[model samples]
Target chain A: MMDFLTNDLLLLSDSAVRNAIPLLLACLAGLYSERAGIFDIGLEGKMLVAAFAAGAFSAIAGMPAYDGGWEMGAWSVWIGLGAAIIASTIFSMIHAFASITLRGNQLISGVAINFFAAGITVLIGQHWFRMGGQTPQLREGQRFEPISLPFAESLKDVPIVGDIYYQLISGHNIIVYFGFIIVALTWWVLYRTRFGLRMRAVGENPGAVDTAGISVVKLRYSALIITGILCGLAGAYLSLGTAAAGFGKDMTAGRGFIALAALIFAKWKPISAMGATLLFGMLEAIGNKYQTLDLGFVVLPGQFMQALPYILTVVILAGFVGKAIPPKAGGEPYVKER
Target chain B: MNKNLPKWVDLGLIPLLTLLLAFAVSGLVVLSIGQDPVEVVQVMIKGAFNPFGIGHTLYFTTSFIFTGLAVAVAFHARLFNIGGEGQAGIAGVGVALVMLSYDWPHWSIALLVGTLAALAFGAAWAAIPAYLQAKRGSHIVITTIMFNLIATAIIGYLVVGPMQGEGSQPQSERFPASASLPDFHEIFGWFGLEFAKHAPANISFFIALVAALLVWILIWKTRLGYEMRAFGHSEKAAVYAGISPLKITMIAMLISGALSGLMAVNTVQGEAERLLLGSVEGAGFIGIAVALMGRSHPVGVLLAAFLFGILTQGGAELQFELGIPAQMITVIQALIIMFTGSLENLVRMPMEKIFIRAGKGATS
Candidate 1:
């Protein structure tokens, strides 16, 4: 057991953190929208559109044999990232339009958005590439490359500390590093700024904001836009970051939904969102690592571990760990006259 | 929005108009891909209505009816049952076990036990989320969706590990012949007419019709349903009237789950004759659209299910005949739901204004 925990688990922990990046970004994405009283369940939808956009842009711009194509380069990843953000923004705007402007049932609107994304991505991708809804694999230099820290090679043999720095922290895609920075920035912007306070107030009591002469619609729209940005980054990272294996149909693979669970699991706080994401991601990585690993006692099913996060969400919501309260005005469209 | 002079326009005209607009937009999309929209429409209509295609259309309709009723019942109670997919999927296991374990002499006896088992399993799956929402204040929508994913993992394990057929395929053995539901062709053959040959449309079609009728009677004629509707309209008022929110929430979701589970009888026993992975497809998701378009009424649900059946069967022909992608059908379905539910006010507001103008004209 000691041998199993030290070496095998350390490697598991490293990949766990790497997998945690997209989940963390997605949870943070949901933080802003729900904070402003707009219950956006379209996180999955937004991410899919972005991933498809990123993949299509990269495949189009950097394909080696395409007509008049430039050699694949780092700029392709940047262009892909930009395309993802723009595409996700447009998709989220439709959600904003229905949930906000139309004052429709937020849940129904969200379900529609999810379907729209799944269909549109596959439809367009197959039409463009003739590759059964798969984007061409990115060549070297066309995707994010793993970066090395100053002493990563030298620190490799220094026991636990070495693994922590060299294996876990260093040599990750640049997006993983940026994911952490975004988490901190999200926490700061949410807790430290005047805008954050007002946004939280809108979720709690949109009536008070409207009475105070603030534009509830405008505040909510901006909140959703921020949500779009984070969701876009998560999607782009899935397709273009160093961890990427190119985009395929439904490649986000319900990570967005898992992130939503983490958002509520974190009690809607940004820092807790990060912790929750990492914990969930670690659960997944461990699940993959311990496939039918037999102990002296009884063998465990890997799927049980893979399903831990969702089970925990259900357990948490069932009041085992106290109430998981959402924003007070969530799922309700703000109507001034009412 | 509810204070309208004409009930017909509210329930009938708006959905029709929005459906037309949805199709117009879909036509434009098809046009963008250089396919002729007129030809597409013609092909879809012909494919869906042709004798051969009608069997498949009705088979899809059978599945949709159960799911639609599942959603409609829950929607009436102000609860969204998004886990119908998982509920139906889980129900497949129960259905398979019932048929495989029993050496029943007749199809009817096997179907009876299988149907009950499916309901029990689906309701058992839904009971957790309902309990969480009723007792612990968890949002039903998110919790149900989460259950959907959990159901996938469970069925994955069941099909692969515990219930795997001797064959390498990740499916159970084909169901016993005595347990298999009779096809439409067999039934029609008794009367000397050739119909739905080799198609999977079965006795479940009549059962679906009966289920819709039962839903109508239950919602309109039962005291329990009154309390559910009362609670949905105003929980505070229902509490004052001595109705229990906890009781209603659990009961509503359980019934909803049973209805969704019934869809499995059509797909697993009636059609596939075995428990296949991904057997539920996306019918549960489409149930939301049917419920919305049906206005959560049984009659409306039936009509909407049929309309969806046309689109599904017809969309297949469109793909096979014209090389148009099947995703176009999904896009159209999404647009229909979005337009009917989310942008309903867009159609309603204008229509309401027209009715108001006409009312004033008639009076003045």
Candidate 2:
């Protein structure tokens, strides 16, 4: 069974795994703030801002190759990564202030963030870059490169199942490997750590966490900053690490919300989120492959194929996979009495 | 000191701030591009609101009114109808296709039929999210956003595909003369302007005004409106009062959809008389800002919509005269939305006295 499945679906599955990495990274970013009860729905905007910053910064670094040097090229990627993190952090702070300090509607704040990000990025991109976006593209040598596993070439000579690991595990960018590591790391931080426990406590019962002498504001800020960093990486991966060569307005698309759906579908568990992202990735990869399959008279419009995940997301939320509950204080902004 | 203030004081303050901010931001952008900021503002002002600018302002306001109301109606039910632009665009195409493909006798009758068709199209477009929210218990915010994306793609394909215009651009064929809305300046001759002769403002403006008044009456003086407000104030309270959340949601979305469809009527049967992707642009989302600024009141929405209309025209004029981007108005408009939305959430009570009086001054 494994042999047959591997032979037929290995390439598609490999591509699905690659696609899911960035989405999984984004979901973890959402999970961080959400588990701490912040409901960072502006994940989409944050990713866009980061992508713009990363792409432009990397490009400015003179297309420096990743040869481990402190040259202008090295400074460029470093600056790009730094800018991506800072931009997303600043963007997330808007959400934090609106959802946390002002006690405004979290959803409205998120919408505002989405609008502001899109407007400002595109406006800046068009006016300043003369590129019609927030920034310019990264030069090829400055972008992140794919890392192949050792012995995978030789392992492909083995029997049916051997082809699966060789293809799926080996044929991915370096960021995909980090994305898998992030999943494991996130699971560890969420389940086995004190901070994770307190985050869950605050999300489920802020009053109880407050009663237990934890600073709800401090915990939430930390969660969001971590989320900011993760989201930056996701954006970077999307623009510089994936097939995309540059940034575009709303380039994150609705992947942020899809990741949110994945977060919910996984019941907020990091490991489950990884699995759910992979499943969604599989859906996308299979959809792409299915377009080429001539079912004759059953050729689905490619638009519908692109919209499949959203349709499924609506279905899942509607009880196709039963009810998925959010954090108790999901969108509530905590106001400190002192 | 004068004691009596204007009834529209609250509405006036935000647009003023928005204007100031927009000019300031545009000035900065101009400076960055090595242009004199002050000169640019002067040009923009001249272009958008000079004696010849009334026609475009009046025509644009006609559609703005419906899109703004579409958003405002949903806010009453606490639903974020961000798909207003997409809905308007889709319905505009629907009406344009029908009117262009089949000839109709009277322009008014064509408008009426096209508007009804647009309403159906808008409702179906909105129903995707409404159904998810009603039956699946999915969050409307996320689902509606998803719909906006899909709608954009669908509209893009249609305009560039089966419904593609005869011209090379991605636009539909112009509506027949019999199907178009009557020119307002020719029909009413109320707002006297020499520019009206160049490009006439039409009857759609008055229709939008009537729609605003109707929405006002519906919201303040009707049972359904009361139920919607109740839902907005407290979903649980509404449910306790025997109102089904699902039913109200569906109704709210449908009304919002229809309002957006009316805006499409102005686009297809009024002035533009053709369909183009993003022609409606972000007006629907901008309606959310208008609704917020108006406090979701019908009269407030009307006043706010007009203010936006004026700014939009003025901003364009500034660009034509100044060589600055006309979209500077958008920045100022967005800034106003941000600050006003924050202002709406600010606590009214004095904090110092309360904190001093009670150690536990945590409550709103």
Candidate 3:
């Protein structure tokens, strides 16, 4: 019984970690933009475009060097990552221009960006690949293959600790580790750096930041650029790091919104964002494992498990669990007073 | 600064110019995809307005009107109720359950009960989020979005588990024929007018128009409407005038959700005759574009919805004729929303300057 429980834990934890990476990255991306006073619901759109770009570029880059031959020498995954970042960054700039430059409604701009990304990606994908808005299946060279941590194999024979270390903590793609690094990096950037101070200040009170001689526009733009890059990583991970070999239509599947919910549940804190996303990821893993959860007395439907993250977010937002106060100047466009 | 500009310019000329800019950018998108922009436009126009296509266009317009009104009503209360998609979806289930519950004797009785069921279910779906936003100060935008996903999950569960039909498909059993709404052919036949037989345009089109008229009166002529607009414009001021934020928010969202639910009358009962998964098909999101283009006015919504109806039908035609993907219309819709809603300043600034100068010269 003990061994069975441990094995199940090991399996569930492994899949949980994999599921959390994209949410972690995107949640952190939203943290940057929203903390800088630009409310971005377009994170989904940017990530989707990036996923498509990553999938397409990787496939093209990994094409055989010689006719009628398969080659695995191409560093196509890295190229795909680069393309994803560029495409997402350009898409984010459109949001910036509308919300920041034009002084428009941020929500409207975000909605438009989401639709624009959804449409353009599919249209371009169908035009180029003709496989019903899906990119070609990526080869091994085109995907971010899993890497075993040092001593993982050596530690595999010990006891429960070894199994946990070998199975749950190691053998993930580079992006998974990068996602953890990003959480710490995001904390360092937001709390410990001078730029982070101004960004936070801008979200709370842009007029105060402007009075301090920092250009609010420049700060907001830089924050959005960071947001775009983070979302790009998340999107690329979806297509390359996961079992999904190529970008499929609407493949993000509301994960972006779940990440948004996680952001709110975390109360916009980086460390808490990690915890919130992992919890949601664990829920997803369990949902994937079983169609219905039997808890001795009643069977809970799988859909309830799938929707737990969103429901928790609503609970948190409603202050039933805790208060989630957004930044004071979060959605308002700042205009300099003469 | 240019308050002296005529209302026509503010309401009419500006949106027109913005739409033109959006179309120009869409043309570039078409060119990027290696399609002729001119030919695409011609084909779309021909497809949307052709004898058989007009019926389909009107059919789409009916749904757009309901969703557009839903968004507009919430906008009046300064609530961004993005849950219209989910509200409409859940309402489809409500519609299906009611219509499938009994074998009704007439379409009129079924339509009446279905509309009520739709309104009740959609409003019920919105109530939790509305309550959260009202009492707890939660953000309506995020809550509405979350509700949309939750609604999707609930609908998915129902269609597959409890509400599944006899077949393997993920949809409920078909409603009885007595519950089916009259199509355009039968309606026009009553007036001795020639109309296409298979058109999905039904009496629901008239219901949508009546709903629009009711919305106009509710927004422009009622005390609640005045209070709602005042609350939207300035919550603190509205509070000073004894308006309750909770009351306004709850009422606005319930009405908005009901308007959104009315759309199921067209898609579920009128057309599909069954509740199919993904029946909403992004019409709720398109409502945002329509409301933005329409300036939240009833007349403007009607026109904007008709325009979108053309694009939707024409898009299908493009898919069939030119091999262009249907997503092309979505791109156009996004551009329209971006230009009219977010980038209005690009046109308004220049136009305001011109108007100010012209006004000064005329006064001199």
TM-score per prediction, in order, is: 0.97, 0.86, 0.98
lDDT of 1 by residue, A1-338 (tens): 85666678778888788788889988888999999998888899889889889888876778665554555566778778889999988877888888899898888888888888888888788777767788888876567788898899999988778877887889888888899998889888888998898899999999999999999999999998998988899998888884455788888888989999999999899889989999998988878877765767987677777677888898887779867888999989999965
Candidate 1 lDDT, B180-263, residue by residue in tens:
888999989989988968898998889899989988888889999898899889999999999999999999999999989999
Instruction: Output the better candidate (1/2) by TM-score.
Output: 1
What are the lDDT scores of the predictions, listed in order?
Answer: 0.87, 0.74, 0.92
Candidate 3, residue B315: Cα displacement in angstroms equals: 0.7
State the displacement of the C-alpha of residue A159, model 2, in Å, after optimal TM-score superposition. 5.7
Q: Per-residue CA lDDT of candidate 3, range A98-128, in tens?
A: 8899999999998898899889989999988
Candidate 3 regions with alpha-carbon error over 4 angstroms: A65-72
Put the candidates in DockQ order, highest first.
3, 1, 2
**B1-364: candidate 3 lDDT, tens digit per residue:** 1367788899989999999999999999999889999999999999999888999999999999999999999999899989999999999999999999999899999999999998998888888899999999899999999999999999999989989888999998999999999999999999999888898899999999999999999999999999999999999999999999999999999999999998998999999999888989999899999998999999999999999999999999999999999999999999999999999999998888999889899999
* Candidate 2, CAPRI quality class derived from DockQ: acceptable
Question: Candidate 2 on B17-120: residue-level lDDT in tens?
Answer: 54455446546756766667667656655554655676777666767788889888888888888778778877887787789888899987887788788888
Real contacts retained, model 3: 0.84
As for candidate 3, its clashing pairs are none
